[model samples]
Target: MRAPARLREDGPLRATLVAIGLAVFGIAATQFTTLPAFLLEPALQGTPTDASIEARTMLLILNFLGFVLAGGIYLSATDRGWSYVDLRMPTRRGWLYVAAGVVGSVVFFVAVSALVQLLSLPTAESQVMDFVGDDQTMVLVMILIVFFFNAPAEEFLFRNVIQKRLYSAFSRMQAVVAASAVFALVHFPVYTAYADSLGATAISLSVVFGGSIIFGYLYAKTDNLVVPTVAHAAFNAFQFGLLYVALEYDIEEAQPAPSHAIDVVLALC
Candidate 1:
């Protein structure tokens, strides 16, 4: 499906504005999902850490709905229905791309971890790690959540919606880069909660940015949202699964602690 005529006619400046507006709306909608978590705060209080599996699960479900709402509202307003985004069952070749995307993303993550360790770069653990915190049950549940909701929702909004929209004016590479920047920046608040300093936060954001770039490139190449969605989901599921193993076996070196060198590799595995 072609983009709406209005969007097709947009110049770079106008397209960039629209992409930014959509990103802002998407971020706000997802943030609104946290309101229900406040109600759970009473139950969540006095936890060893601030994270609660129940609250986190609820929030992720709400976030999935919120992202869908945001994307739907924007598409409706723009007269571009859901079909405008390239979401479909993957073709055989598309499945190959999906496999490549997943493996490439994992390799990229490992490379970044090694780089960080070799340089002793300041970094922060993802806030999601806090939600799992030595709980095998939480890790298992979060693995499902990341696969079914968290990864798909974020990919739908960022890669399918934002990156595709940017294609109206920007080249594929440009759109991918821009969408990735937005994706990374939107997670700044979440990362900051666990980051010790601005440098640490920046490093965390860099990792997100790099990962988003991989997802965006997959979407651009395959022209199918499913390619990136599955890849992203698998990447995230790997992390949660690794965390589960760490908790189950009491693998102290593999726990996602920012101070541990091996944790970085395992965290992204």
Candidate 2:
């Protein structure tokens, strides 16, 4: 803990490269660790159990860990602590920011839905949501895990580490746009893993890119990662909460039950 500050303090290029390099290696480490279940079936090994559920959940956990590892490496290399990435605990006003952000997130969803409809934007269900489906037990556990792990990791890397550095190196708009673009680009794996069409992937990427811009701007304005982190987690949690609500609602009704949340949401269409 007493190591001297050895890395340079102000080089955006170095910071960006270090962050990205660590992220790539971390992802590869996770992918290698979790590839077996996809390649081998339990029945073939006489296990006679569906390991797919565990496998999928592990992937989410591991990916979150990977992003954390990336942040850890960047911090270590930079000889800085969490504050270097604007991860200070929120003040009273910060809490208010978070509360307001939740409302903004709800508005974001509605606005984006309208945008998609207006543009005829291709859309596809996110695969992460599959791991967080209507199983209440699973959903409850994932909410905390995602709030603490995935949302924090992403905000740390994208806003604190990358955008913070960019802010010092360039104008505010350049910093936010560049950092958000990188944030959105890194999500390409989801496209390959889940999207059925190029148009679907494009729209998904565009939405994520736009969301990243919002998060980046939030972090810039508030000077706290917690604000954006909480907002991002809230948005995701609400999305899942909606699914759970619709599912439970239909399960109560005598009408035909939907297989997934989209079916319930798609009634608008």
Candidate 3:
């Protein structure tokens, strides 16, 4: 779609490499700073705490930077500036696609979470729920990480850059498949580290990869990154808000579960 947005050899390659390198760095950096804050300071593995809030906030900021850098690289690589495009706003059909993506993602989360619980997968290294039921500021900060930082950055890398690059090199259909695989690779460490059951992990990840394919197609069809970016953002924002409500009301566990759907989506990509 849209001729795969011709690439400038040096322009795209340089940018992509930088983005990937930075993301790798972010992972290392995140662990070094985050582990101690989460584990040593308060050590609240099951419940939300002030220390956990600080630790997660710090790590989230780092994670946000990683996504921003990568997204910047990806956008530059395609010569698609950061400016938003209003060309053909979401048609009814486009809205349908977005809706499907959201529904599928939710199903994936529920199924995966259930599997993780049933299988007794290893718990997340840090206490994710420990951020819930805390100060409103802490909750807001967590929201920023999941919605603002994590979602956009990830979709840009997976859907915008990798998906488009592969699409440039191959047919549209093949590009979708290839991008889906690459997206899945990004989640390897997280998924393996988080999932409780092998079978559930596999099935859930398949759902994730599948979602990537869909998102990739949406980007290709629209030749616009905003569509996928918004889709990604909306999906994440919804989950975060829902989780916040659940935790705030004590209806669901506050900390993020390893089998968390959004996490799976990231892994799927």
TM-score each candidate.
Answer: 0.86, 0.73, 0.63
Q: Which candidate order results from sorting by TM-score in descending order? A: 1, 2, 3
Best by TM-score: 1
Model 2, CA-based lDDT: 0.61
Model 1 quality (TM-score): 0.86
Off by over 4 Å in 3: 1-55, 71-96, 107-127, 130-140, 252-269
Q: Which residues of candidate 1, in runs, are more than 4 Å off?
A: 1-8, 44-55, 256-269
On residues 1-269, what C-alpha lDDT tens digit does candidate 2 reach at each position? Answer: 12134333446676567546654554554454434644554331222123344554454555566566666676787687755766678998888878877777677667877777788776755543334344555555556655776678767776777777666555667778878777656666656456688888777777777777777777877889999999878876776565566566755321111111122111111
lDDT top scorer: 1
lDDT of 3 at 204: 51
What lDDT does the true structure give each of the candidates?
Answer: 0.73, 0.61, 0.56
lDDT of 3: 0.56
- Candidate 1, 1-269: lDDT as tens digits: 56678767889888777777887787678657656765666443234235566775676577566777899899899888987778789999999999998899889778887888899988876544544566778777767876787777778888888898889888899999999887776666666665788899898788878888988999999989889989988887776666677778888656542212112212221
TM-score, cand. 2 vs. native: 0.73
lDDT, candidate 3, 164-218, per-residue tens: 5554446667767766766665556665766675654565566567667767777
Q: After superposition, how far is residue 255 of candidate 2 from its true place, in Å?
A: 17
**lDDT score for residue 162 of model 1:** 88
> Model 2: residues >4 Å from true position, as ranges?
1-23, 32-49, 52-59, 81-83, 118-120, 129-134, 251-269
